[model samples]
Target: MSIKKPLDPGQEAVSLCQHHPREELCYSCSDCDGSLACPECVTSTHQGHTLVKLKNTPDFVWKKLIEHYIQKAEKFEIPKILKELKFAEGKLEQNRKHYQELIGVVQQRGEELKEAIDRITMRHVNTITEVAKENTVYIEYYQGELHSLHTEIIYALRKCHQANDTEDFSVVLDSEKIIRAGLKLPRVPITQTTKYRMGPSPLPLLESAFGGVEIVGYRPKQLGPTVPHVVQKKLEKPEPPKPALYSVVSEFRHLTDITSLVPTEDVYSWISNEEKKEVVLLDRAGDVKQTTGLSLHIRDICTSPITNNLWCCSEYDYSVREMTTPTNTEVRLNFPFVPRALALTHNEDVVVGTFRKVCVYNMEGEEQFMASADKLGRQIVASPQHISVCPTSGNVAVVDWDEQSHDGNGSPCVTVLTSDLQLLFQYRGPQTRALRSGKSRASSTRKNKKEPPPSFWPTDACYDAAGQLFIAERTSKSVQMVSNDGTFMRNLYTDQEFSPKTVGVQTGGFLWIGFDFGIVKVIKYKQ
Candidate 1:
């Protein structure tokens, strides 16, 4: 401390002020004369001299200067301005849509009013014109009576003078016919009647009792298209400006990963009156965190035609999973890993629909068949459960999403394949018109063009014991029954309101219908 240079009053006292950034712990000397120092600076000088503080000191001035710069940067930020602009644009679009709706309503009301006025006017005009024609006949009769008059006419002339003028003939007209004609006038129902003048009698029938030319009410004219219907656009208050932030645009999908779905309580069993046996239980076991129920993600399950140990799946797992149980009544082929859809061969070899190709597997966990990469080009949307497979002589008959998915959701047709899985022909069901015109092709067998009835959306399909295809339509809320050779048959629904998710056949046309909340149906054939 003694070796340190002493600060002098004549020279600059190099120290910071009390108002510096770290001033809370600064605790500097009161008379330090810290012109060149920070607020944390301490000093031993200015012990007892009369001190005068600077007005609008440099520390305060520097703080204000930094704050001014920050405020300027905040005003010019792009994100802040862009946010306000977007809000304004969104409000304007909403106003436009609202105004458009109001304009449509007003236009419709105007048209309705115009048509009503036209109908009433035609009937009223015809009735009024007939009354005017009848008055002409009455005037002719009065003139004829005057021509046949004798010296009695002199007395009639004196009576006419007493009545005021001869030409002013005001006699009370008899009008039973015209009064009946007024009764025939069309009645117009008016809504919201206020400030409108209506005749006290509603007709000219009481004109005889009143005996004066009195105007009862005004009639409305027919409305025309020239009338401009006005609808004001409701303007809203402008939203506030936002703080600035950085942003960038990217193309790839950032969709959220879908975790396991939680199972809901409550299931109901459905049955036909003929069978009377409850096959599908509402509260099926093994869905939640438990054993003895079915495995996870098993949408639709089908037993293999060749072996009792093998089964295929479409909804739950990607590849086929086989059970290694000793009894072997269980499912036993877990080979393909991630099979969205699966079909069994007559020998129980599994054919699975994958992301790009159809991977065929044997019971020994070997890849027996791998189709070409373009075997199903661009057909995998929503990751490939969308394609339905109908297996034939060791090969696959595929109906992909390439056509009906992109163009329409309707079931287009099933493609047949040979033993080598070559495309043989496209079968549009037995009903041609329904296939082309969107009618239920499987429901009707008619050969002509007809109005279509409601149908199903087939997502996954397989054949039953009768060599018939049971198609699980995603949207039809039912399964379509078709022959294995690809002829349209009928539709199967578990319940009237239950939507069909996945379908498979075990034996005797025994089909399993999958619905919501882990409930599956075991159906028995009726006819």
Candidate 2:
């Protein structure tokens, strides 16, 4: 065959249509799965078929393939898979933490058991050693007695032999003394071997002492892609209307300002007057049930929910005292810093607010935790005036009055924190009324129209059964209700006549608002 010439650089090699050998393939038939066709074949064999130029067929095929893959990828459920992967990672992390905690518990218990076993082993060893020492002494005494008897018998026999050989009465008489000694040999000392027997193993008891692990099995019903069910939304029940302060049930007037108020489980309350340097228990009928005088000025007072014991702190003595009612017996707990505010948690632990720190103590006055700075190393409070612990959540809420604030505002704020002292949120006050009116503080100052809004000065705060905080706002002359999350809900009661200095909530929906003028009003609340 003649050698085919190499194609030029600028020219492309062409294939001839099978149907028409002379004609070059000029197009591709889409309906025929991209079969090659020439002009003659296109008109005859591939008539009425979708055709693409052979030059453009490769790009068209590539685009169609890409589109097909795009649809497939969209239906692959990749997002759901990624979410499941993240959930699994989180679960693994939780498992790690839980296992670590369990391991620590097991190790601690094991150490305790080891100590107990060591003590028991030492005790048993000592007992056996003492018994062995006594047995050794007895064995030595018995050996000496046997040696003495053998010597006596040998002496007596020697004396008798001399008497027989010499036929002398003197030798025989001497042998009699020896024989008497041999005959009088101490009765064979009764000896008993001391044997030690191992007691039953304590392995089973120890296993129960430390506790056993529980194995729980979890089975997933379906592993992979499943059709999600269409769940109908359930109607939520409407919340009951919040109770309003209908009327004053009873009002008690004091000669001195009431610095703190604590309602008790009984139909009485404990009120402290710093000026009077005393705390009094008042009945529902505004009668003084009992009065307790303090040597030092009382800064704040609270009552234990469990024991109903009165607890008060003194800034003068730098101490917290628990007073058992009726007997008036006092138990003093000393602290490094002066305690200004006092509260008792639902668990009967003491919560003390000092200059700039909050401390927790058990009933015996052992400090469990002290919180002065936050995780960021920033001081949490400048001056804590009052403290309250949420009965439900155990959150500590403090009325922080910053007299020496960096900004020199000297405004009081309410700071809420977890039991571990993690900062939650701080409430300065609600949005200024001017701000609600679309007026800025800068605008007001520039126009000289009105003074900026007054700063919030909270005197005290307490939580109700619903976990809502009732704050005594000295500047606003109102008892404000705040949600547990620190949002200002509404003013529970506002009085232009008196400034509330302290607020307390009692069982059966009663609000005890202590005013600056030494007036305590018992208002019945609906909620």
Candidate 3:
């Protein structure tokens, strides 16, 4: 409870404790709330207290303060603010460009609609005019016949009057001729009146055609607090447990040439065969729920997350069909190129993989975006055979193959892209050493001497609940699992006899895999 007086600028840099005015202050007492103490004060008033020597305190305190300042300046205060500013500026520029493009699209669509309206109006006008002209021609011919009959009647009447006065017999004969002409009066042309039948207003349709804009709020990147060098050296986090196949849950047979398999929220899956042009819905117990026969051969099939409607792709007709029931189906979209794969995103957007591009469409069948090439204008995919969308991240994964390779199998890779169509990464199988290490020695040595190890030919892909990608490799006869960040994690399953053609991951940790020989095996997995 002592009050120390402030020292003057000219005063010496040494202080005496208030209680011990004769003794110099040489210690700071922690128990007394960091109060300065003299040797006599520590022993008498603040005994058994933690004390820091005043002579040694300057180095430790000043050094800590300097380090804190340096860290704030280097890590958070200066660099973070600068980076955030740059990011905001870049975002603004991107927004400007995006809106500008939208405006251009609206203007172009307006012009096209106007031109179409004009053409339709002119066509209707011409049709009405032509019909009116034909009707007028018939009316004119009838009027001419009536005029001729009137003239004959007038002549016959004048001749009859002369015959009455001068006794002429020829006048009666002329009257008879006039009567015959009048009896053959031309049949009155029954002209049907033409009028315009107006249709419903196009306001609602126009509003849908010119889709509304979606404004997404900007979210700044979050940065963690800067840690000191000493505190940063902590134990590493343990790796996540690798996924393992627990058991074969079920086996489905009787379906021929199963090209695609899509699992629904329930214990059911939809499978299709291109050769038979049939789509069958079956439960986990291998019981067929429904069967649908389509005219167009199905290339792939996917179920909507929201409505659970089946979306089927037809390569032969270059179209996609949406089926609500076994008998109710409608053409969802028609593409210029063949649609090889189909997938529905978390938002229920339809994703179709074609010859060299993947296109994303809203449920209304309007194109939202497309990805075919990289930012550098280089071709990203020669042929997108299969497509999958991550449920959590909305990221798109395409199994692309080089269709023009010397061997028909072609080199295949999985191209991962962000929801916005930005390129994330491409995974071209794992290293050869990693593959060999996974196989047993006997299996590795049993390979044909002439035939080398088959190359990676990914045919289909799907994302698990944990965002891990499961890709089915046709030539390798294995299903590869990739981490969310595009790292090759490991092989989930391998079969030496049958090649994997398609893969589907259900909600309850079940993986449904389809082979080329029309067999589907459902396996339960654990992480």
> lDDT of all the models against the reference?
0.43, 0.76, 0.77
Give TM-scores for every candidate, taking all chains together and pairing residue i with residue i: 0.33, 0.50, 0.49
Q: Give the better candidate number (1 or 2) by lDDT.
A: 2
Q: Write the per-residue lDDT of candidate 3 for residues 1-527, one digit (tens) a residue.
A: 24446588776556777777778888877676466789998789889999988778888764664676687779888988999999999999998998899899979988988898899999999999999999999899889988997787778788878888989777678487665555566688878688563443356577887677776797444324464645444433457896556678987665477777899887889888777777898888778899887887788888887788999888788888889777878987887878887888867778888776888988677899988766656555667777888876888898877454411134457878788777777777776322111122113232233444447778899987667889998877888888777768777888878999888999888999988777888888775
Off by over 4 Å in 3: 1-244, 405-409, 432-454
Candidate 2 structure quality by residue, lDDT tens digits, 1-527? 12223498776566776667778787877787556688998789998999888676677685775676576657666777888999999999999999999999989999999999899889988887887888788878988998988887887788888888988858767667666554665665555555444333345577789898997998554443343343211223457896555578987687677888999976788888876767888877778888877677888888887778888888786888878765464756888788888888877888888777888888778988887776555666668889998877888998887555322225457888788666777777776321111111122122323434446889899987667889998777988888777778788789879999898899988888889678888988767
Residue pairs of candidate 3 with colliding backbone atoms: none
lDDT score of residue 477 within candidate 3: 89
In model 1, the runs with Cα more than 4 Å from the true position are: 1-302, 310-319, 326-337, 363-366, 372-416, 425-456, 492-495, 517-521
Worst 10 residues of 2 by lDDT: 434-443
Point out the worst 10-residue segment of candidate 1 by lDDT. 270-279
